[model samples]
Target: MSSTATKTKPSTNPKKKKKQQQKSAAKKSSAGDATGDSKQKRLATDPPLECSKSDFDSLLVDASGLADYGEASSELIDCARYGEVDAVRAILDVWSPGKSKDGDLPLESGQPARIVDAADASGSTPLHKACANKHSSTARLLLSRGADAHALNDSGNTPLHWAASAGGSDCVGLLLDHADALHSLGRGGRLDVLLKNGFGRSALTEAFASGDTATVQHVLNHDSAEEDRLIGGLDRKDASEGEADEVAEGKSEGAGEKSDDEKGIVHEFDFLRCSEEGEAVDSNERPTVLIRELVSGMKSMRGNDCQGSSASRLYIHLSFSRNPQPIKHADDPFGQAPEDDTTGLGIWCASLVMARWLASPSMVERMAGRRVRELGAGCAIPSLAAAVHGSPAEVIATDLNPETVENIRHNVELNSSTSRAAKLSAATIDWGDESTYPPDPVDYVLCSDCIYQRDIVPLLRKVVSGVLAPGGTFLYVAPDGGRDGLPAFISSMGKNGFERAGGREAPEGYRSNPLRSGDGEDCFLHFHELASTRYVLYEFRKC
Candidate 1:
């Protein structure tokens, strides 16, 4: 469609549009780290998604929000935002006039990629608008017509980032499917989940910010899903070689025999195992088995090694163990436990993600000059993270078990950095006994990947409530799904003088990619370990 073909210019309210365009100073100041200042400024001023009225009922669409794009394209943007199927079809037909006759890309118009992905002043493509609004059908149509999935808006977010923030699997799944398909078409199939926004938030970060576990899981399962499809295709042709042959093969392999690719993850069982006393259990009841990299990060925990690379042996060190121990609060109930040791001895995905968050510039700001406490310290990754990068006044890594405490202390000693020596300490803080609560004030509490068992919810709340000083924030994380504990914990805490923490005191927004802000190897490993599960982070403060 020609820019002058229509007369409608965007009538977005100026003030509202400006509010939407404002970027945090950290983002504006950090452009030098990614791209040139002038270019980043121009793009930064063009953030995607502005609520604007469409020709239809007050439907809001994320148009270029810049009226300079002209009338015809503006209407197309509105159609995409409104998810008007027929309207989009009609507009595309007009733009690519020759394609209506043959039903192919508008070859005569140069290419449909240019038309469909045409950005407005805000740098948002039609696909960006569609995905942001969760219009999957519209997004699919644009993809079919050659929309560029990697096209960035002013904020540097691609359609995949917006889809992830939409907080559901459909849009994310659609984008992933097209990413693979688009690559086959030489149109760039792989969507860059690593591409950061103005605030250094990636698609995965958006999923985290959206507070939706399902979306997180879908993105994490992205590569594995592809592997499954490939394996299925390979096995299909061979399976049809007569019933006799298939039966023989099935008998040999046995029914429901999963591929060894099971990684180190064995089976789903109670995370609430016998570890209170850290004593050995009966061999038959709790068999002592140790699978390297248990199923937790089996495929992804090692980062790329999850795909097929050899073991990187990237283990995190904690207190007194000279040997590295894993981190987790409750039993590694969700999955991915080291077979021989209690879950407290194995690191958990949520803990890694929490460590990543603690390492971020914004999170560091929140922790600086404050006293932080880590409950169910596990391997004390968060405590290590705070001491090493947060510049906190103090960081106490605590657990119910004396053994875990010694391990935590040993890990702290192993670190031996000036900051670690000055700020980090480990102690035994029994969750079941309130008398063990320390007298020192705590400004923040870090708890992750331990909220699996139902019985522990009430006491966990009590521990946090007892330890945290007034106005102190509680940073909690756990799987968003697959357990009954989360909602119950939230509800119990909410009724007992707790409220969702939000304000100037808490992090207003991300200033950098939390997963990428720390030591490259540790941060990258944490990022991948995080992607292996559907964990979600929550921040709360005393009411």
Candidate 2:
């Protein structure tokens, strides 16, 4: 067999050769590169080892730009679509976080997003392809490298939609854990709520359409049995403590059912709509920091930290704003501004009151090594006080509003001590969504002036039940105004498996009369009026 007999490839006809040359010239002119060079192709080639830095860097730039320029396929995207984990990992290993690309995700990170999240002409990403094909490993790799789970394709289907549609329960589980991540807030502004597709079908609907029972159940109950091993959280700790069997058995038997102990003993306790548990403040344990002083020091660093008792130097950011409209009642010192936000940019007396309590030597000493969380912590003064003064194991300051959470983080950044800063964290948490609760049940849930409306009591109670550990304490602060908020909380909590442990007026020493009188009321303008107004603290323990 001669070479000519075996391989007769060349076209000898003049017209055909001329036409082929013309087509080739046109392709070269259009493509602008005729060598058929590939970048990040090392990940897809034989051997499949990570490429050298020089090759990877050049390839990273080229592969990163392919989707942006409207090409349907790139080295990374094709590798992921083929379920090439090693290839995807090799590409990602060489990718740098500092290196950003134009992904065009709905809520991208400022200017452009991560290359792992970049989309092609069909709005499909490497992640979407991996999920759509049920390639869990490749999808996980892409997610670990910052893939946006909620990114939509041309048809408005998120990675979750494709994962559920493919009946990829494993992939669906991973996406659910991060569904609302990367700011996937639709009309409701919920981090745990995944948006529906353009057709109004959500991931859950897609799961049902797939007719996969496990997928449907997993979608319905966000916390599946494999949640700990998969998404991970406080519940995982039970396994290490040899309590996995009991816990798993209990969840399996009666996950949504409340046992007798959980059934509140409302029959035994005498409760009233506007009644409180107790009204006694120990004179010996009273706070020395004047409530008036807190009003002045709130906007800055001076007296916020237990009246500077903590050795750690701390600072805070608070912008004074006028009351959207001045209310006749001086009870709400830090009332809503723009007539919408009950707590605005300014610090509230409730937060200061709680901060004063948290900074107390008794509370501070008891809080050490405890996990504490504060809801609606404007400026996060109480949470910061716990972190700085008490040195709690961790203090999470949470709010439903992202702007408020950002402000909380801003305050966390101003504190000078790295250790204290490390102990304090800020996150957006919704009271209504159980999925948004911290992975683990918290030891203590603190609230400051959050219960002012009858509507949110149920949500607050729901969150408290979801986040609180057995016998964990919930300390709620609300002013004793004629508003139905506090009364509603008192009425509902008594029937929700909670025991009202104690109640007390914001200690007499911590109260001052409103009239600024042009004295030491320089901290926040309207709040000076709230500093002296009365606040009641209620302690409820989960049974």
For candidate 1, lDDT tens digit of each residue in 403-455? 45655664565344434325778887777687889897689988975666677
lDDT of each: 0.52, 0.52
Global CA lDDT computed for model 2: 0.52
For model 2, residues 1-543, the per-residue Cα lDDT tens digits are: 011112222221110011344434433343333222221111111223234556555545544544432232356677777676655664554443443243333233332335576666677788888887777777777776667766778777877778777767877766665443333433121212234566555565466456565555445444221212221221122121222223222332233443422211000000011112222233332211101111221232312322321111111111121122232222443335412233434456677667656666677777778888887776676676667656678889887654456546645643324234246788878676777889988889998876645676787888888888998989887677644566878877766589998888876534432111211212212233244357888888899
RMSD after CA superposition, every candidate: 19.1, 26.8
lDDT of 1: 0.52
Judged by lDDT, which candidate is best? Answer: 1
Q: Residue 303 in candidate 1 has what lDDT?
A: 22
**lDDT for 25 (candidate 2):** 44
Q: Clashes in model 2: which pairs?
A: 512-532
- Which segments of model 2 are wrong by more than 4 Å? 1-344, 416-422, 512-519, 523-526
Estimated TM-score per prediction? 0.43, 0.38
